[model samples]
Target: MAPRQKTAGLLDAVGPAFSRLRRSVLLDVENPVPAKDLTRTLVLNIVEDGADGEVTVGVVAERLAVDPSVASRMVTDCIGAGYLVRAASQRDGRRTVLRLSPEGAATLERFRQHQRVAFEYITRDWPEQERLEFARLLLKYVDAIDALRAPA
Candidate 1:
């Protein structure tokens, strides 16, 4: 097969693989706190990125590649569910910043553990070095995609 065809096949496979993974591990998990898919995703992002400081809704939208209105609604729902908290940004009092609640952090950890176990099971037969290389390559691919989408 030509290189373009090989790339197309990989891209085709990625969509369904991601959907299956999300449904099996992330979206369908039973958690102590009930949350929609977007809410759960937002919590996880906040846990990973909000530790340094508060994360803004705009930032979440940008990271998720979603519309600002969509992100705003998800953030509001998360706050109502007690999974996230919004506070004034220290740097700019008028600006709002988001951080996960303790409950949100705990829930995110549980989800991470589930994902880790699932990945381990799926890659159990792969050699350790191959697994590490796969991870590195996946990160590189994602970064390349991000760079392509970024404004020049």
Candidate 2:
């Protein structure tokens, strides 16, 4: 195959592979979290990235490329599920800060553990060089996609 054809084929294969992997990792287990819950949790994680404490819902929404109302609703659902807490911001009384509850933290950790295990299993037979190369290429792909979505 020509280089462009090979690249297109890889992209096509990768997209479906990701969907399959996502479903297998997140939906195969008993009492699996629904897609919405998983998405909300991921948003929370993005908000908490490298942060010591409370983050505003707006920040989370921006990171997730979603509207604030959507973020607020997700936060409310998380709070109702005992996965998040919302409190009046000290710096801005008009705003609310969202933080993960203890249960939320534990649940997120469990999800990460499962994801790591799944990844390890998937790559168990791969050669070390191939694994490293895959990682580099995946990161490059992610960076390129993210850059394309960057605001003008």
Top candidate, metric lDDT? 2
Q: Which pairs clash in model 2?
A: none
Q: After superposition, how far is residue 77 of candidate 2 from its true place, in Å?
A: 1.0
Error of 1 at 78 (Å): 1.4
Model 1 bad stretches (over 4 Å): 1-39, 51-54, 143-152
- Segments in model 2 whose C-alpha atoms lie over 4 Å from true places: 12-20, 29-37, 50-54, 136-152
Report the Cα lDDT for candidate 1.
0.73
Enumerate residue pairs that collide in model 1.
none
Model 2 TM-score is 0.69
Pairing residues by index, what is the TM-score of model 1?
A: 0.70
lDDT of 2: 0.74
Worst 10 residues of 2 by lDDT: 45-54
- Structural similarity to truth (TM-score) of each candidate: 0.70, 0.69
> What would the per-residue lDDT of candidate 1 be over residues 65-107, giving only the tens digit for each residue?
8999987887887778777888889998999888788877777
